[model samples]
Target chain A: MSGPAATEAAPAVERWTPLSRISVVAAVAIIAALAFGPLVLNPDWVDKLTTLFIYVILAVMWNALAGYGGLVSIGQPAFFGLGAYAAVRLADAGVNVYLSLVAAALLVGLAARPISAFMLRLKAGEFAIGMWVVAELAHLLVNLDGLVQGETGTSLIAMTAYGAESRRAAVYWLALAAMAVLVGVVFVLLRSRTGAAIQAIRDDEDAAAAVGVRVLATKRLIFILAAAGTAMAGALWLATAISFQPKTYFGVQWTAYMIFMVLVGGLGTFEGPLLGAVIFFTIEAWFGGSGVWYLVGLGATALLFSLFLPRGIWGAVESRFPLRLLPVGYRLRGAPKSL
Target chain B: MTSNDDGAILAASGIHKRFDALVVLDGVDFAMRADEAIGVVGPNGAGKTTFLSVLVGAHQPSSGRVRFRGDDVTRLPAAERCRLGLARTHQVPRAFGGMTVFENIFVAAANGGGFSRGEAYDRCIDAISLCSMMSVANRRAETLGLLDRKRLELARALATNPVVLLLDEIGGGLSDGEAGELVETIGELRRRRIAIVWIEHIVHILLQVAERLICMDAGKVIADGSPTAVMSDRAVIDAYFGEGAA
Candidate 1:
């Protein structure tokens, strides 16, 4: 035993294990299958998939902000509105509709930088409501402008040039790609040194500062990044419908759905949001058109998940199974030769 | 490493701290030499923890200058001060409840101490072992017992590789056996030549590790000298066991 132990140090287990490998393989297979969806699926299914992608993006971004960064925000729709408006205004100004979608995301992300300086001042519960107030203000401000027709709504005239089939495919593919990029960015980020600093701040701001984390700076960065992601989803959403309405973009319902998805899936884990988004999409697709009962059903499901599964479905599953598809923490194995 | 020529590692003069109308530390002047462990004791609300907070930059002094290695750092943030080799443990243990015990120390080593990845990993492991918390290093801090939490607090501070460490009430809730173990850990740190200023109510435990004792009362240091002498001082006994105890 001593000879083997001396010959090689205890096996250092990294975050990536055999289980993670399997999870990754499964995820890649699913993504590849989804990529071919528009080719085989009916137009209605493709449209539903696009909506699912948007929800997934929104849920993941919200989780990163509130669950990991400890900045609960109810104002995500503010950035979403900005992205939608930017996309519409840019397209109206004769920019390529697809290019405008990308530009809108960038602009909203840049805009969040300055807003963060003010918004991040509020803590926890106050921060959540403060964000909602900001969104309402943004909604009011956007209505004052005439280019957006003052809440009369506007369509993506540039995209009208494409055939219905082509437009649907473009929106589906872009939405899927955007979701993949956002998830990939968040996944890589949480596995980095900066991610560690951000999580430290989440645990205790004072303790994090004591350990040399630039608290304000880290919070600001996360806020802006999450805004960019939510904005991107909003922009893609505008492309999907080819119409821009301030009320829909800035509505509190958008944020409510994001919260519900993250809460019912898992608040902090990467897999939780994904799982939550899928479950939410399936339920909506099956019963969404049932109107009042659909809303009631969604509410009841969320309440049940919260009451019995506070960690959400993914969290509960993780606690029971101890599986991590996107592990971001370190794990050591085998005892050292001596203390 | 200090440029004071007198080998003073940390110096604070005319330190005053106030929260609204309440004055916690009143015109306190304190300094420490290299590798010296000073024990600070006081009656309840004597500003012992407040003074430690001031030294570590957790609480900015109302009016005073804190100099570390001859450079004025009164305006520097706590995080900056920690990175500059001034570190402290809280009176109430503050652990990152969501993270494992090792991650808490790792954050200190990598972020506060500015160690690289490999060095931070090694330092975290060493700190856990030093604190005799290797068995629970992988456990979440929230799940640890009180003694383990205190050990984690010390390990977190130690991982920062401070030249001067301020510890507040680290021995407050420990049993005799656990306190002895903690004392041995602190003794090893003392042998390593790290300057320490410990604020603890347990006089005997403080005396076992600290070379000198300073007693405070109502925001003033009434006595400062050798442990045995300070403990027997008229003013110190009066502050602790009442006016007639001396």
Candidate 2:
């Protein structure tokens, strides 16, 4: 049905911002520079950057889960550990290690479907703790496997066959590629119709349902994506570190780091978690030697950000600059601006 | 159960909704023809909102059936019902706080109406313009004042391209001038041939647009007729003011 014509011209909806356009160029340049990191950076720095990539993957996945989907899972380490184990089993069966990483991610993503069906029945707090229980259960189940070797851990022996320098460089490239691909996937998803539904679910579930958003289905999709993404990060971490201990892989500290990173960067914004990961990496690199004091400092910093900068650094920056580097929201042109 | 032989666009029969031991709606039956504008009014605790909830599939009736366009929709979820051309607004606006006003409407147009991106954009522009929300279309929904929030609520529902729209107290907490504007916009919706079931406390404003009126009390509809007739009904007057006052 036609609407009554307005006295003025109809407003046009614009998607891209000036900063969003510049961000595209900036992202390309950054990825290209990072691609050359192994060639110029020292071996130690190369390895550190690979580790940093793992952190980025984790933060981004967690942000998508809690920030967008409104599913605050504290049990992501379950999928992370499972991914590492899946890769280990694949490598043992003579699959190429690189191929095993991708396969591991896909397998974990599929596994999350049934789990999400059960988990989605729960509300906010119940879902969060339920995930932790699921993660603990996975840790126990993995411990039962002979290949896991009961806390002694197992090395990715296939990785040992390659020359040290070439292996490090190749692994670095793989980590970089995984991070880039996952981030791109999330970006594209957020720009789609499904992305709008996901954020709508986050804002208010009942209203979203009334507005015709398939809330459960959308939440399940995000849950699966997050599971697969986190698993990819875990598999990459396994390759870089060259070892997998169920205890360490399934440890709660991974979830803590994810929370810290996402909280410090920004919870809901696309660019927030990325910036959070960088800030987190810098802090870890600088003060990791402080041992126990470092842990205290990290906790203290996250608490301060939560209290004072509740929106995180990116939120503060956006409020001041009014720019969107990744504009998922619409902008109406030819409309009177709000005071 | 009431039969749908009258060619009603929407119908609900014998709807009984109970929360624990308390009954919010007791054997409530309602039917509306295509493009019919009905206004629901009742005193506090009269179950007006609860009946709307049951009709829109937000709250399932303990025992009853809901049908839309000759299809059984009692078992369908709210989203499914919305996609089937049934949409609703909450008494309190529930706009997506992080999104702009335009995005809120766009989402409904795209998802509820199942339109392509271009069509959804066109639908959004129509809904926004009809609701007189053009000036603040780019502002975040959370920043909107009460009147604009109500407008966003109506616009979002309109964007769904609904065959039937259920509004729960859309005029609540609005000044007389603000509500008058809403009445005009709603009148425009009626002209577009979209059936509306609006629940409001403002009787005169509702009377201006409602072709039929239903007054409910204590989980039962006490009056159902033309606006003037329902307003003059002894039971409706008694429902509004305590018993024996009429």
Candidate 3:
């Protein structure tokens, strides 16, 4: 308050950290390796990794909505179910399964605009439950469709056109591509002006509004984007499993998994969901055969994380180290040396 | 009704706010010219904060109109009002805990001022420098002490490039030295020609920067005049103390 003594000579501010730079190169190498996963790894591992990619997509989108936007939606399965059903209907009409997956995801994203307008009116607990009601309603509506034969469900029979090895590789690559694109989208968004508004809204809605942040608009954007990303993951899951059951697609259990992964990984950090998805995939691959016990173990781990490491695994690590794999924050440093 | 032709930058008339029969504000009417610094003093429950809220569009009045620069902004949400150059700081600092101080100010510059990235960066730097917050610009806002938090709140509002800044008890709990520093910063803002409506309990510090004063009692303006004249008014004295004592 004395004067501008300290800021008279302002130092430069940069966004990239040392670890973030290394992360970029490492990420490229890892993604390149994963691209050839079907050829290098066994078909079963390929299938598992594909499922892991889907988990990453769902976890990242959920984190964006709940962690960044402060919109804790327990009804993301609404769009997920809609996407699966859209893909199924398209496939049944003789469209290519892969094209149906992409188209269905876009269609669901569009559908989310109106849904978000209504859903965003509810806050906190009401918003959470309102989304669940929407998912349940979507499930019932899909049941009424003739293409969806009630509880018995239907398969993406068009997928039979591809050979087993070809299908597995294609689905793996599609899931990987979707995961990469969606994660990139979220990353760039958080680095943008709108991303700051979203985080501000999450921190304090009234204060954010007082500061001129368009709270409802920012929340609505995140809601629609999360819906689209979740739908893509759902469509990819259908590709891998080749089944379209409204009960399965619209089940509340999907949202439960998303919450578990995000909470266990890190709620708000960019790298948290990725770490969480990897840990979740490892657990599911190892103990998923244990049935109800697997679910119980997941619940317990989530509880432990929430109780002790409330910031999640990546959050705990970030607190200890000056590392950021996906840095969306700014850091001040000395002026750069002249070239 | 106050017309915009008279050169009032912000004006509120017939503001009646009630919460289930509890009238917080009763037909309060006020106006401020461009670049004028007005201090508001009142006893407890005088609805000073609610008045600021109504002006900033944070709360809707039961039956009233608020005009900002000739536009009817009564129905506008707080964010839209802010983007139109109406910004405020809370009595209790509401810094975004998860963001760094610089990020907090930058958000106000970008979103509130609707500036481009480069412009926002420059505006944020200017605000931080003016508020003497450059030392903790990169610190997490949640980690700041009370004085720093208050400075951040002021800096955030300044970053919005507001035509009128509504400050709610920003100097309330500060030490004498800290409050003096804030007054200096606010005085600098006055020189820059940003109109300020500061509500403060510390009348001496309020008098330092404010040429005009308005005293409220029971949600009505009991006195409004020059700082010394308003302070000496019988109504203000009676409201602050008691009728017989005054």
Compute DockQ for each candidate against the true complex: 0.45, 0.69, 0.53
User: What tens digits encode model 1's per-residue C-alpha lDDT throughout B1-246?
Assistant: 223334467888888899999999888877788878999998989999888888878889999888887788899999999999888998888998877787788889988889998888888877877898766766778888888888998999999999999998999989999999989999999988898999999988999999989898888889888999998998988888887455
For residue A285, what is the lDDT in candidate 3?
A: 75
Which is the leading candidate under TM-score?
2
Q: Tell me what fraction of the real C-alpha contacts between chains A and B each candidate also makes.
A: 0.44, 0.78, 0.62
Query: In terms of docking quality, how is candidate 3 classified?
Result: medium
Q: RMSDs, each prediction?
A: 3.1, 2.8, 3.0
Instruction: Name the best candidate (by lDDT).
Output: 2
Residue-level error in angstroms, candidate 3, position B181: 0.3
Model 3 regions more than 4 Å off: A1-9, A334-339, B2-5, B244-246
Candidate numbers sorted by lDDT from highest down: 2, 3, 1
lDDT by candidate, in order shown: 0.86, 0.90, 0.89
Candidate 3 per-residue lDDT, tens place, B27-59, comes to: 888988997999999998999999999999999
Give the per-residue lDDT digits (tens) of candidate 2, residues A205-283: 9999999999999999999999999999988889988888899999998987998999999988899999999999999
All candidates in order of DockQ, best leading: 2, 3, 1
Q: Model 1, residue B26: displacement in angstroms?
A: 0.6
Predicted structure with the largest DockQ when compared to the true one: 2
lDDT of 2 by residue, B1-246 (tens): 777436999998998999999999999888999969999999989999899999888999999999899988999999999999999999989999988898899889989999999999989888888898887888888899988999999999999999999999998888888888888988888888999999999888888889899999989988999998999998988777758545
lDDT for B158 (candidate 1)? 94
TM-score of 3: 0.96
Comparing candidate 2 with candidate 3, which one achieves the higher TM-score? Answer: 2
